[model samples]
Target chain A: MRLKGFRLLTIITALVLSNNLLAQSIDDVLNRGQVHGNFGMDMQYYQVDSLIGASETPDEDVLMNGFANFIYTNGSFSAGFRYESYMNALQGFPAQYKGNGIGYRFASYTNDDMTVTVGNYYEQFGNGLIFRTYEALGGLGYDNSMDGMRINYKLRDGLFVKGIIGTQRLYFEQGDGVLRGVDGELMVNDFFGGSLKNSKTKLTLGASFISKYQADQSSQYNLPENVGAYSGRFLLRHRKISFNGEYAYKINDPSADNGFIYKEGTAFYAETAYSTKGFGLTLSAKGNDNMSFRSDRAAGQQDLLINYLPALTRQHTYNLLATLYPYATQPNGEMAFQGELVYKLKKKSFLGGKYGTGILVNYSTIYNIDSTAVPTAENDSTRMGYTTNIFSVGDERYYDEINVEITKKFSKKLKGIFTYSNMVFNQAVIQGKNPKKYPDVYADIAVIDLTYKINKKNAIRTEIQGLFTQQDQQEWATILIEYSFSPHWFVAIMDQYNYGNTNKDVDGNFNERIHYYFASAGYVRGANRFQVGYGRQRAGIFCIGGICRTVPAANGLTLSITSSF
Target chain B: MKKLILLSILTTLSFTIFSQQEKRAMPSVNVTDMEGGTVNTSEFNNDGKPMIVNFWATWCSPCKRELNNIADVYDDWVEETGVKLIAISIDDARNAGKVAPYVNGKGWEYEVYIDSNQDLKRALNVNNVPHTFLLNGKGEIVWQHNSYQEGDEDTLYEAVKALAAGKELKH
Candidate 1:
């Protein structure tokens, strides 16, 4: 293994240096490089609020999380590093991020069709069924960048290959297990270079093999030190229709996720879509069984996850519908599907008014995979916990939801969007809590959003949202209003109320029913932004740009600053 | 390791201050178009016209408002300035397929694409969604802005019109 890696390093070095040979001079190369970066800082001052359960105050009074990235690129050569500091990290951030350090650094160069990177990098292979690495940074504080060497090369005009050998990042350090993977993809039409080269129908096929190796240190049950997984994927597209699918299978090598069960795991995902000028539709399906893949077996609750299974439900943005009963993917076992349709009502039609109206309908459902216990004399001495069929869905449902939205432009200065959603959330399963203690939550949500353009340099937006349920915080409503002063400043205020909370407090008073109000203003100048807000926060998952994080309930003053150069 | 990175950054900063000549070109990062076709960022162009590159996502409210507002005046902007607007979705695979539907549902006419893994986003140093950039006719990045407030498109339009008039933006 050592010799092979050395040879790969030598070849990559040669390819990288080949481009430098053609440069005019070293000074010329140095002069052409560019420096760019981005910086972000989030700070909060906590205040004790007995009403919202924010009783504990930090000893320092202020907590902050900050990071800055610096990248320099010169033609085919580029390098970058990220500096992160958490002065006793925020309330919800990972506790391990307590100090300042260079969290990420990488050196990469590309020559011709070959690119090589050493140090750290983020990559995804074929839907990330078996391998993916990324940094969510501020929101989740989740980063799994591989800290090692990676090489990507194009064998031909249509064939590409990438190989990586590294260990996953665990907070401030690297995980103990080592991961190795190689992937190849080929464009069928382009590779053939014949009748299908320019055909409307296009096809791409890919395959990847990834393996993780960890030393066995457990004295109880013998665990497989090496676990390998493979995935096959294809993309087929035509004029108005497209389909993509991937199937992954992994060898039996469990440590803790599945009670150390030795059952082989499998997952399959498929997505198809059709779109036209003013209409679009999509359908997606996923099946997974005992696919709890993690670099460290003992790690739990969003740690050391090597593979990813995207959630099939709609990503709601409204405060009530988004944070109350949001859906999260179950990595252990699930059968899920989603379908969505979007259509625009033509202008001049009865429902369109002067401007066209937009309509969106979406549905999603998730259920546990059917599994039956293996009847063994020694109580499953084989350790093959259960038998499962990919096609069979069990009676226990995880989540189900359907929603419809209508958007229309009432006039030149006014527009409104109304949405209604019905969902059944099995918190017992989705939250991994005791089933007997918690019942499934049934909710109906509604939201109305409006925006009025006061002028070219100012505007106002408002959102009224409500969520009604019989269980888990009975009923809730939220109202938000924001005003903008064009290219410079804006202000906003919001209030979330739990109006129908029947649960009583210790003094037989309905103290649980409360109002959480927050207000803030922001300023933007060129590439810099600064905002200050004071509010009461609830305990739930908040997502920003696809990254989700669980924030603890708190009452505080928050400040954020961001800039790029 | 931290010291090494700091040293390298300092050295690069000095080099930049000492010799700054060439304009920064678009990074060659591969992202998928809305139609699932691979497109390299280096090839992004508008046939000698100014281009507006906007980064957005489905779940981001401000991003949606910005794009929807742009759609209202897109035809006028295009006919008057001959500018091309490119909207890039920074959504992950979870919502990749929903992009086209959402855009079409709103009847937006901008060129749409997907950066599922955020390769181009990272290369462009986009810290958050609603980050907008303007490129000249030669496809060289000239002006950039982060985040958005309603009516911010007017400022973006001013930049586009200036670029179309063959003027350099102070940004």
Candidate 2:
């Protein structure tokens, strides 16, 4: 512990000296006493019967989280800090984070072609498959924020390069390991000069190299001194078409998650999108095997995540489906495909009358990539690298979803949408970890949405949805009605019924179904608005991008407010 | 031809209305210069200068590229449109102290703003770092961009010069 303290003090002294020695500005120091800050408040109330292993808490209270940021900038220099306070923060937030303190601090400067910064900062490379740092307020996670040094340089034409080296921040302290990376990019907007500018084509090429090094835990395994990762991406854009693809490879460095020894990993992502006027199409695919790389291999969600692989599945916002079975990216041996198409029917012909009609169809699927582990010698009992068979694919699909929607404007004041979905969900892999919860086939969902515009100031929307799944849960139906007075006021009411669960009680009666109802109202006066709702929120899967988290069932009142000056 | 003229007239009318809209509300600040001079934000509008306010961090790879991209076109931008850009650094104190020497080493030619406390961030509702806000001569925000890519600066320049030349964007 003394050695650790000494090392930290030494690092801080070195950083402070480096800051003072370079670009000394007395004028900035003398006159930079101005104080400016920003404040925000968020509160949530939760009532849950079962959350993880915690006992049912019939408590009713509000969780408050707010931050005040103050910055003082002088010329090419600035220093700032953030005061963050959380009193029983939002549900699902870590229980340990309840105190208020200076959460972040930094000083920075930039010139035309070069910029340098030292401090705690957030950053991302490409789609962040290899490295991304930023607070995901909604996700309740700030994966990577480094207390470190960064340097950037711009070359001739469109060539650019950047390098960052630092210790990732974990909570209020730094991580046990170190994260470093470098990235370079070339923009081909006008390739050289102007002759090709008129051509209807554009291209961008980029390459990035990242490395993580952590001290070996002899008690765990003899880890490699350095584990390196490299990724490359290409982007192309034409009038109506755009395509992007990235590939990443990593050197083996094993931890507890994958046994003791290192396992080499690789990941690939590609996406293509085409849009013209009212028509759009997108197709994306990703494949990965043993690719979950973190700075501190031994640390799980508590350490710094050097990369973030964006999930390709469309994030569904509906509460019921979002809470039950959210798909999480299987970083090890998974192949996924997603495609979507949207078209606006031309006017005045059959299905496309005076009021144009629109149709959208989308599909996504994920499967395991067959893999084999290398056998360890009897004397050396450790699992190191694995060999992957090039020709073998998993025998069964993990998840598959197909959905379609049709939307039409029936009149000047009316519009409606009808949607249908067919999905085969692997509860074992996607939701419940129990192998007994195999794939649930033929889960069908249907939805109808209608909106009536009484006038420019008044409008109403109504939605009805039903889901039929015989596997784990029962048949479900939902109805929602919302009324709005354009410039200011709005109200909404919704109810969900679970009528088809397969579970049975001791009396042989199918699990007793449940119904949840909620009503909410809001009044918006310019930038200041307040909204509150009361009701029971059923359990469901909540997904963003392709990352998902399960939101447990709960009964409570939800209130939100926003004010701006 | 008559219908085309009508469409053009309607477009002009819509642009006029959009241009008349009020800028988003934000707090004020005063930044000191390298030579110890103070530059107040409120004076920016009265000075009849178009300010390009870019929020960036040293660790943001895209922000670095974005600065480089703009630098390549900056001279032309200033010569033809007489616009000024202020790159705000959001690096905190631990790393904040290194920014000056680093910028000097790179030799960039834009005025810089240090927003350690993120005063401007909350004022602009910056959900993400590296968000850029372009303000017109009257200090009304005219355009903005969230993320950066290799060729994204071209679109940004077009908006800046167009607004400087007293023309409203079509979209």
Candidate 3:
């Protein structure tokens, strides 16, 4: 810990000295540099209850997590660092994130057409099929930033190139593997100068190659020390229509997530859309086969994920629909499709009344990809584990969802939105549960959200939602009411009730029906906000962008403060 | 314990020194537009008019609600004050393809840009979405806010009006 403190001091001193030197040399040209930052902290006090499965309580009554980022930018040069403290990280966050340190720091500068950055950085290649490093610090606690150097150069007006070499961050330390990648993109029309710049149609093409090097440590199987993956992408747009597609292929590599199979991986993603005036339509499809690309072969569960496979299902906002059966992307092998249509009725029409009415309909589904296991000896360790063809969908149904939403304005002071959804979730496959332990779930959900403006300074919004199902906790209802008083203060209350739990206990009695309730009040002034709340949080899978983490149940008082300048 | 105390002191000192400097200009970072073209944020100018830059994502409920509220009164805001609202979506590659269609579906009139890699977001030190920045006619960031609530647009419009009228903003 002392060494960590010294390291942080050195970094800060170096940054300050560099900024001072640059300011002195470019006094007139650059002027005084600007410093901006944001700070956030979340503190929670816990209580234990065994009835609702929130039995484990921390030894420490209260847990706190905090972070602050400070950035200084002057002309073409900039530097920043993030300080994080997890005095015993809160529930649902990795326990490894306990303590205070400089988790991220970087320095970068740009001169004309070239830019260079050193230290910590986050980057993504085409569609993130091959390489991506990012942080989803919201409800999801996944931060895989790379500690390395990156360079980007603009060869001309239409062409751009980027190169990066780094080691991925694993907890507080760097990963064992070294990562390297390069990407280039060109806009065809822009490359032709101003000749077709004004044309209604445009075309852009890009390609990327990434590789990771790690020492082979397996005693039984001869694992590849270096694994490479390459991808190509294209985007074509013509007036109201647009199409985007990317295809990636990875060389044969054995990894723990893939059962140590030496099978090559591949993925394809394509989407097209057409839009005009008040109507829009989109269709997308994706297929993945043995495409679990990770920096470390032994890393499992959300660790060292070097790529992203997006879930094609619609992301619901209603609490019940979002929590009950949200689908997670299966990176190993899956085929999915999604289609959506959005339309608006013209104002002054019968259905539209004084304001236009909006409508959205969406449908999506996912299925396992066809694969035949390669026959091998029972004890044989070195063998190809599977054979599969691209786009060959299997018989197992993974997930399906259909939903519709309508928005209408009843009066100048009142507006309402109604939504309905039906979902079929395969719990055994997606949730990684025993097939005999949990049954597949089918559910229907409906929601009504209404907002009423009271005079000019105060407004009230309410949401009433219900989810009906026969399996897994049965029926549920939620209600939320929020009152906002213009630019300063707001208060809200939410209650979620699981009214139907039909399963009987050992005594032949129904399980306990629980009500999770929470209330919050916030004060906002310019760029700072302070909020406090007390609530009973139910245990569930909290997800963001298809990545999920199991959040434990608890009854607690929570306080959050955020500020940015 | 001694090391921790020393670290805290150093951190406080650094922040004090850094904050004493003058306000900084927006960093020049390259972002992608809806048409798949690269655009440098330093070149962002609205013809000598105030611009409201909003950072949002498709998945954030408050962000969608705020933008929708602004969309309802955007035309009048533009006519009253020659202010242009630029919406920058921080959607990553996972949902970047849905942004254009989503915007059109809602019939938003603001100029939308994609910050897929969050370059501009990090450069601006924006911690969360629904963060709005008010840039004066000269493209200097005068005021900014994090998060949103109902009727927040009214306060934002007031700032734009003040900038247009050459008056100091109260907030």
- Among all candidates shown, the one with the greatest DockQ: 1
DockQ of each: 0.36, 0.03, 0.33
Candidate closer to the true structure by lDDT (higher is better), 2 or 3: 3
- lDDT of all predictions, in order shown? 0.84, 0.63, 0.83
Each model's backbone clash number = 0, 34, 0
DockQ of 2: 0.03
lDDT tens per residue, model 2, A143-167: 3577888876666465678798998
Comparing to the true complex, what docking class would candidate 1 get?
A: acceptable
Q: How would you encode candidate 1's per-residue C-alpha lDDT over A1-565 as one tens digit per residue?
A: 9999897778655544543343335448667788899998888899887777667677879999999999999988999999999997988678898899999999999998899999989998978888888888676788988999999887877788999999989889998889999999998887888888889999999999999988888776677889999999998989878898999999996756887888899999999988887798989999988888887776776777888888999988777887778898888799999999999898889987798888889999999999998755433436788899977999999999999999889988899999999999999988878889889999999999888889877788888989999888899998888888878888888899999999897899998898898787888887788877789866554422112233444468988788898
Q: Model 2: runs farther than 4 Å from truth?
A: A1-40, A45-55, A58-62, A68-81, A189-191, A377-382, A389-392, A507-512, A538-554, B1-123, B127-139, B142-171
Assess the local accuracy of residue B31 in candidate 2 as a C-alpha lDDT between 0 and 100: 41
What TM-score against the true fold does each predicted structure earn?
Answer: 0.92, 0.71, 0.92
Question: How much does each candidate deviate from the true structure in C-alpha RMSD?
Answer: 8.4, 16.7, 8.2
Tens digit of per-residue lDDT, candidate 2, span B65-100: 467447646899888878888887765422232234
Instruction: Give the per-prediction TM-score of chain B.
Output: 0.88, 0.78, 0.86
Candidate 2: global Cα-lDDT?
0.63
Poorest stretch of ten by lDDT in candidate 1 chain B: B1-10
What is the RMSD, in Å, between candidate 3 and the native fold over all Cα?
8.2
Q: Estimate, for each residue in A241-291, the C-alpha lDDT of model 3 and write its tens digit.
A: 999999999997688888888789999999998887688888999999989
